[model samples]
Target: MSNPNYDQILVHIIDYVYHTPITSPRAYQRAHIALLDSLGCAVETLAHSAEARAFIGPVVPGTTVPNGFRLPGTLFELDPVKGAFDLGALIRYLDHNDAYPGAEWGHPSDNLGAIIAVADWLSRSQAKDVTMETVLTSQIKAYEIQGIFQMKNAFNKRGLDHTILVKVASTAVIAHLMDLTEDQALSALSHAWQDGHPLRTFRQAPNAGPRKGWAAGDACTRAVHLCLMAKAGQPGAPSVLTTPRWGFYDALFGGEEFMLPRPYGSFVMEYGFFKLVAAEGHGISAIQAAVELAKKLQEAGEKVSDIEKVTIRTQKAGKTIIDKTGPLRNPADRDHCMQYMVAVTLLKGEFIEGEDYADDSPWASDARVDELREKMVVIEDEQFTKDYHDQKVRSGANAIKIELKTGSEVPEVVVEFPIGHPKHPETLGLVKEKFRVNMQKGGFESATVEKMIEMVEKDDLPIHKFINLFAKEVPLKT
Candidate 1:
């Protein structure tokens, strides 16, 4: 029997994976940076987050797969599926990885969890000859796939988390990495579409918690699992996206078809934002604005205690996602809450760090933090909202004004772009510095950290050898 016609979306993804060749030198350069940056973020998570560390081992302790992938920054060797979860969770736990803001905001680097796991596993077990070059190419393609989908699709508005894109993007690239035929790749992608996606509630107030940290890991795990199933001869639901009432469009997307505003390429990687400061993508600018205001206060010998009221102006997406005015339950909650981040930064007179959001951190329990939060008002700026979604000008703008108790008002501080934005002059240097700091914190020697950075630039470095550099046996805290 002839095969059924697949949806254009599925066909486009499969074709891109098989046919697109990454020719952009800039994309590869950024991918190299992204790879190291993601690993550094993972190391940072291992160093600071006990909750993230608790989830790092295999499903069953002491169970090991021969020729399993080695998880960076730890000695755990596991099959690609579990490795994907550990790596994904570690890279994303702190919300410090790179982010792409759009109709649907996400971290494209999240797909690196699946890409690195599969490539390392294949090279070790099957001797597939996957190299750093291969990994970079895959990273570019995955970023393109996820980033393009995010450009015009508003999945969050439909109450779905953005990790659905991570799953689909990872599935496509893993199929190519495993040398699956086009038909098999289509099958894998169909399964990704058919899988139930997590709700956005875990990222919102009153429900925000640690699950937000590992949702990408869960998506990467599912992606690798679906690819394995497809490799084992699973059949695909050809029209999973468009098959009437039961299709993804009708069932989950409210009958709106997914949009691809641009063709598949390296645009996402080149233009992605790195989180130099550990906060939600939408609130990075707000945090920067708060920091600027805090600096002004410090220069004038003003204390945070003197501020009677704070007003934050942000984009609509920011208000929709991180403008929370309630009790933040954990690090995940605090990082996503604009008021909490701003209050913490203003209190410290510096940029917010990952630890500041931790439940055990003093800031979480500080009455001053909550008091400041209570006094703040978050309002949406129409132009900021427009610029945030505009294809030609994607800006995460936030303005802050402080009203002092002495009956004085500080001029509004506006930060249109946070550090690590592509347009920022210091982005590359700061990103490299962040990686160095995170690597050393994860137990790498300063010399070795420098060596690893240099090694990632080599195109022909074997995948397993590259992963081995991060395989230190750091003991987990009980």
Candidate 2:
């Protein structure tokens, strides 16, 4: 008989992923769109900074594995471990992938690092067809695993970064992707639980830095490593989560047990929101409110100098994650700051972009941004907080109220969901635009971009063909 002491959480996840049948056509279509969206994010991030490329590719030059995993936006074919880091970091570099908000906030698409790496590697090394259909099914499963755990667990509250879920979720799905046995899957997941969790300090004040951008990638790399070890016959930690005083729950989760709101399925990818603008997820609605207020200011023939004070009301998650004061350190710092996002939108009277947060960008050093940050006040709206946590609503609500020098207040503009939410049918066009623009930004030719759109739009494209299209390398400048 199987050991009765195996961690139930790991067992349940493995069984669901292995046993569940994806019967919903809507789920498959959503996953396909998400794959395209995430690849767009990866391509765009390639131009963010050369620093990102340092962590990708083979550990040494000219050490390529035959039929190895191909990274998107480059020609490097590497072992799955390094490939996961490359793809994961690229997808998350700009924080532009899909997000699902609840008790915890995370980019569920971050798992694409491991999902794509292992799937591509398997297709090339093994004889599996690995169609786009297979990739979509795996993507949906990974998103569900991560999103469901996020629904009820407040990892940030315990001072741990939310990417812990990335490691766990990726490990489960990647093990399945490699076709590991149930015991090997169990061992792989057990190792993920034991891996040290990253502190959220890099994501917070006075110390915020670029690590936040690549932390998910690091988690993805580790998840792949664990899966490989398990396949090599590593022993499973049967009680990793429930061990007395040392388990994940007691040690890292503040002694509270995990609360899974529902059984695992395709619900998360079905409802996940893509970012129309490349900013922190919590601050998107606030950015929208600010943009509306800016339009109103323009119509009233008002200048940004006419603004006396700015008040922002948002969900508690927003206040916890993005609220910041004092000197903004870098692009990472600026992007995560609520006041900075609002200031740029109100001052420029346009939607913010990833380049806007660059350290050398004029906006980063603009005195007016600091001026607005000083005049801003952020508070939590109890109802917005409640609605954000409500399963049915799950709205990332925020309201912006600006006061003029004339002692008159601009009408408070509130947004329950940002433009990218699935509820807004109009955003489909915008997401398509974002994909095209990002592809060009990543240095692909216009014809290549058109071909990518054509190929991805087709329902019967094979996964290996899609991967090969992305494998075409851009010529590096001498």
Candidate 3:
């Protein structure tokens, strides 16, 4: 029989998280919106054809956490691990999710990897009675864990995707949900330590496409598997991050534990941006710049030909990732290409998903777009760079100051915080809207969509029931 000793510890932690009330308002608020936004992402992404389906999808996504925590649209019940991966992937599959500028790691909503998987498995298979409170607590705990680890953790710098943090956080949260004693929690962490992180090859060029979005889901899957093993009396190695030789410090982290410029708390969730578009983070600034400039030129009734040049100054990440000057072969390239977003915005006077760049129908390479691009010089602004590094005000905001052949320079407009900024407010309303949009995109009926919004808002819903709602199996399009 499975060792009851390990099981008890796991069960206890899960119980505590499930029962604990959320006192932090920000945590509670973030939970509600993230719930909708994440669900939406899952709905929209799972709607696509490229997604893998059925057969061995998630036969028994474990059980034990709480009720109402089901994988949206799919009835293939699963362990929390599978649930986490599925839900996390669903949410992140679309590039439209919340992010933190301080997180330099793409998006923060990726935590769904651990939250969904662990919660479902514990409630379903393990016979745990998880509740809304439990989900919130665990969600917060996982967010804190991931965000804390992210303070100084530069995964991309190490050529690893930021989703590694999701794995770490999810592992910790899973252990907590399992009611693992401190020792058990630590043990689960050991497994995480033992398991190496994947290279960021999927987030970069050529291969840098949809996989970048799914990397977080993959991490959650690994987190659940490790947690389960730990709950089964598996041993873990200590000092995984600092060990000599093959240790993470050398083999992975390069002999450094992350340096925290600030404490890990609700900070990440609060400041994280909800991507209004699908392009990578670095390109946001450039896109904003292009959009701003296009607005002015268009208002003047001027064509792209009248434009003298388009110049963009951005951070190192933008330069390294999206600053392309060639044929954008696919949507993946088009998404990140600074010129593409800018060019499309200028020519069409708008940038929408279907119009600007879709896999099937692509915008032809226009000389006008190129003309603006040729004259466009992108450089790094020293002050903008400084502001970006300021811990107290960490932002992914961009400043655009453009000049025209008309001999007048457009006023430099700076956006320290984009829409959905936790500090800027209205995030809840925005997130709710986004969630509805996602559900609609997934083709969810009005009734199903309304039920989800109501359930999430009450915060008293069971994890299993939540699962059942999503269990409708968001169908894939041909």
Candidate 4:
């Protein structure tokens, strides 16, 4: 195979994925928790609809291997490429996974599809053997690769989905997990860089739908495919980012190279915020602020329907992403709309969950929701936007205010950090509760749930055994 001086970006990613010591026990602990939490998110999505159930499993019916990689919360066992797609899609199905805020916004746990699938498959099929500890280490590295890149690269600004980072990160780490040399890992990552990215159009109005949910999973699947091709001696394009007029820098990135805000480490996974609610990450703080506003209105015996106007003050990212109006096409549209989230919470006096945004839900048909959304005005808060991008103060802040017809107004409720922010003290407890609820919804037995938690707590558990826990057949809605 042809090998040239690799791009510095690929070199940094390869070296870190292969050589990082990951000495932080806390990092590993957090990774273990993230794994369980991702699985919980996967299981929860399994019940969303039978259509979701149809997306996973062996590509062809009755296809079987004695030790194929098992996707969590289902009985599917397949080649790692397809398996990665399945697990990645499931974790991201509800957009409820952990998030990192930066110039670009993305869910870093989206890499787990390739990481877990390849690790577990290697453990079952090869002699070197993999372990949950190994998976956690790779998980940390993947999160760092994706999250660090996310810190300053605004992919959405280029109309690209943030899953490009998912593909790059997954390819780098999965190459390492497959026991490739560092050079091979670099080659694999270069291939990933050369791959085309999906547009963000599917995530915005006029076409927003389920593609946003599966986009990251699709990236993870492609990453695995690229790594495997690299392993098979496929050549990589070393100048994919820098090559003249056709390179990513000039052609796609507006001639700007990626910015590295920090060195890669376990930092992202450790500090990445979990989602307690099922809405888009940008809208979480707004949802929190709206919930608080609803409580005050209740105390005063006021009604949201009587509101003369509603206003939302949010970070620039929130306004760019979730601030929406007009008819929401589907769950994908509703969950990403800041107005929809806050309006629903104000009307119901409760946090919005994944199911609440379903196209057929009562909230979708409620004229009150649309009415409230119509009365809402969303604006960017400069300070909130500044704090959101600040390394030392990474907060997704939002403020909500309502003016009632009676000429009285509820004081604006501002939330600097939602419940799942790393700075929030109760984040861990809330995450565990979120996981428990999802697991129970998946119809997993209490004993099985306890065992899964035990595995995450223990170090160095064999990967095959861990994968086996999720192999039990669960009934799917027909």
Candidate 5:
């Protein structure tokens, strides 16, 4: 095997799968969830925006392939590359895609657009039979590619975006699933290298809106495009991420070489999260811990009005990104603001996905959320901070402590990881359910989704039939 130290993750994963055996019950489970949730997000956002349709809709007739992943609300049966991006953009249009928490932000599940697009397209268009096992295997490999990279690299600090990892991870995984030769996989990596990443404008304010969600899918879509080109004798720029002056590390990453916390494996796939609520950023963990504490206080008969101050101690990442103080201007801002999210959850006993962000949050007029925001002092817990840096860990840990006006303080409720953490019981079950429910709710209810999930899990399903099902028509937007 080639030395991984010198290999980009895209190249390294291809080489690793060649030599090692990788699969598990957990890996298979996560694959199903990743597919379902991503599709659900895609379907939900399909009719909501024109940018989504304008960008992703071309995939259908653009490619010669008739049977491919059927993007909701459109008739495009795209080639794998276009399919990946189309699907990615659809799911991510609202900035609601999944995330991998760290000192620097990482979106682990972003590559799903690429993985599912290729898997869906290949199984449908080509005679290649895709099974649950193959899909699971692909998910695991993709997760490892994205997750392991996020463990050490801080992309945002260098003025780039996290979707760059999506590009690398998706390209390598697609290359592998297509059964590309080792040389071909390396070529795909080169394509990924030359495929430049978008700026971080999508994640920040003023301009910060829904684009952050689909950015990864965009990266993945291009990944499939490059891989197919390489298969057709197209050349790739091998040192795309690491050329001395114009390479990825220097051009985008502040000249810092990509440092991986671990070798590629099924580890990341096992631990990915499904965003139950729409606000998916640095607060997945803190939101859970604080929500739990809020419920406990509410159960104790303490009204939000009686709450004088709320103190939340957590890893610095949660505070730095989501921890905001002021009048939130939009849904994007409200979702990320620590005090606002916690306050809504406490006030209504639930977090509304797309409620009154334009007008005031019902409690928006309530001085209490702000009162809570003011009383809330976000401090970094040393242990939480320490756990966040550990390589073995994926999501940054979070802890919340609340103080009430009644002069009684409950024991601090600290969630080591959010509900979506790999170790958490909810990650697998909730993620898949979230996908199925959201998709059905969005309008593309079909037998194909179940068959697709089954194929991903058991590896014995007839992949062509599944792909053909996507070609079947559904309700069009009126």
Candidate 6:
């Protein structure tokens, strides 16, 4: 029997992947920056987080795949599935990679886990002429697919994690990289949709933990695995999205179809947030406001103890997601907590870093941080919410107001765009600097760091060559 017709969403995605050519210079430029920045974030995770390192590498020790992808910042050479997981986990573990905010917020760079792994492995094993340019193109496409879906879907509101988009985006792009036909690509994508999506519970209070950090990695692994299955001749559920009771809509989306607000393109890569600081995307502006408020307190000779009350006015999404007020159990919990991030910034008079969220970090145990958290109130600003969801003006606006014990109110500090926003004047420079600092923190020498940056800037570097620059033989901790 002839195959049934594919869903329009699947058809659109496969068509974009196969026929659409990415000619936007801005998209290419942003993809290059995102590549460097994401790799830098991965290296930084290797340097700072033992918990993250422990989760990487092959499932069985002392096993290696021929012509496998080499994970950056380590000696492990893994198959594409494990490679995707390791790379994705590293980029996302600290939650410092770039993010695209919309009805559903997620880090578009999370797709890099699958893109880089599949490209690098294909280049090595099949002798395919995959270059950094190809990788960047795939990155742009993946970001566009995931970002566009996020623009109109509130997966979190349905109690699903946004990594569901990551899985779908990565599968579609990886299928293209693997040279799967449209039918196979559709089959792979259908499998991705049919796969069970993890709940958002791991990212919320009472259950927030390391699973939130590695969720994207898990998605990337599934993407690679599903594509490989499709390449091996698996058939697709053509109507997976529109199937009556068991379809994606009815089973997971409350019987509502996904709304694509725009055509697939490079807009997401060009406009996504960089996340220079180590806080949740929604709370980055709040952290900036808190840092500024801390400076004001220091200038006025006021201590954190003098703050009688603190009011944080933020977007509705921010209030819904990151406005936590209880004991944070881990880095995953703390980083997502607006109260924790703001409290740490207020106490230190500096922006919160990845180290600040560590369990052993002084700030994590400081009673003053909790005291400040107790004094702070988070409220949703309707205008901020509207701005956050506006396609023309995607702002994660946050305002902080402070009242002193001495009956004086500090002028409210409002940070509408945050430092990493594209509209911010210093975003480009800071993004580059962030990559440099991350490389240095990951233990690369100054000259080596410069060389890596230069290599990443080049358009024709082979995928294997560019990926190998990040590999070093650090003895794995037992």
TM-score, one value per model = 0.98, 0.96, 0.85, 0.97, 0.83, 0.98
Worst 10 contiguous positions by lDDT, candidate 6:
469-478
Against the true structure, candidate 4 has what lDDT?
0.86
Write one digit per residue (lDDT tens) for candidate 1, span 1-478.
Answer: 1233888889888888888888988888888888999999999999998888887888999988899999998888999999999899999999999999898899999998999999999998965999899999999999999999988898999999999999999999999999888899999999999998999999987888899899999999999999999999999999999999999999999999887888888899889998899999888988888888988998899999999999999998899988888778778788989999999999998998999988789999999999999999999999999998887888889999999999999899998888988888898889999999999888789988988999999899888988888988764542
User: What lDDT score belongs to each candidate, Candidate 1 first?
Assistant: 0.91, 0.87, 0.64, 0.86, 0.66, 0.91
Selected candidate, larger TM-score, 1 vs 3: 1
As for TM-score, the candidate ahead, 5 or 6, is 6
- For residues 1-478, what per-residue lDDT tens digits would candidate 3 score against the true structure? 2223443323333343434454678777777777678667766666653543432245444443333345666655555666666677767765667666543455667877577656666666556777776777677766665665565567778887778777777787777677766666666766675776778876556665656656788888888878788778887665555567877768886776566565445555555567666556666655655666668767766656665656676765566667777555555566667766766765666544522555554465555655666666667766666666677665666655666678766666566655565556665676787777777767778898899878876666667567667766548574
User: Which ranges of candidate 6 are over 4 A from the true structure?
Assistant: 1-4, 475-478
Query: Which segments of candidate 1 are over 4 A away from where they belong?
Result: 1-4, 475-478
Error of 1 at 25 (Å): 1.4
For all predictions, the C-alpha RMSD in Å is: 1.5, 1.8, 5.0, 1.6, 3.9, 1.7
Q: Please give, for residues 10-71, the per-residue lDDT of candidate 5 as tens digits.
A: 45667765655675777666666675666667666664444455565553344645775665
TM-score of 4: 0.97
Worst 10 residues of 3 by lDDT: 1-10
The residue pairs that clash in candidate 4, if any, are: none
State the lDDT at 25 in candidate 4. Answer: 73
How many residue pairs in model 4 have overlapping backbones?
0
Q: After superposition, how far is residue 105 of candidate 3 from its true place, in Å?
A: 2.2
Q: Which stretches of candidate 3 lie over 4 Å from their true place?
A: 1-22, 49-69, 354-357, 364-375, 401-412
Residue 141 of model 6, lDDT score: 95
Give lDDT: candidate 3, residue 393: 62
Tens digits of per-residue lDDT for model 4, 1-478 = 2234877777777778777789887788778788889999999988765556877888888787667888888777788888899889999988899998999999999999889888888898874578787888889999998999889989999999999999998998898888787667777888788877899999999899888888988998999998888888887777788888888899999999999978887899889999998989999988988888888998999888779999889999999988888899898899889999998898889898888888778999999999889999999999999999998999999988899999988999889989999999998888888888898888888888889888787667888787788765755654
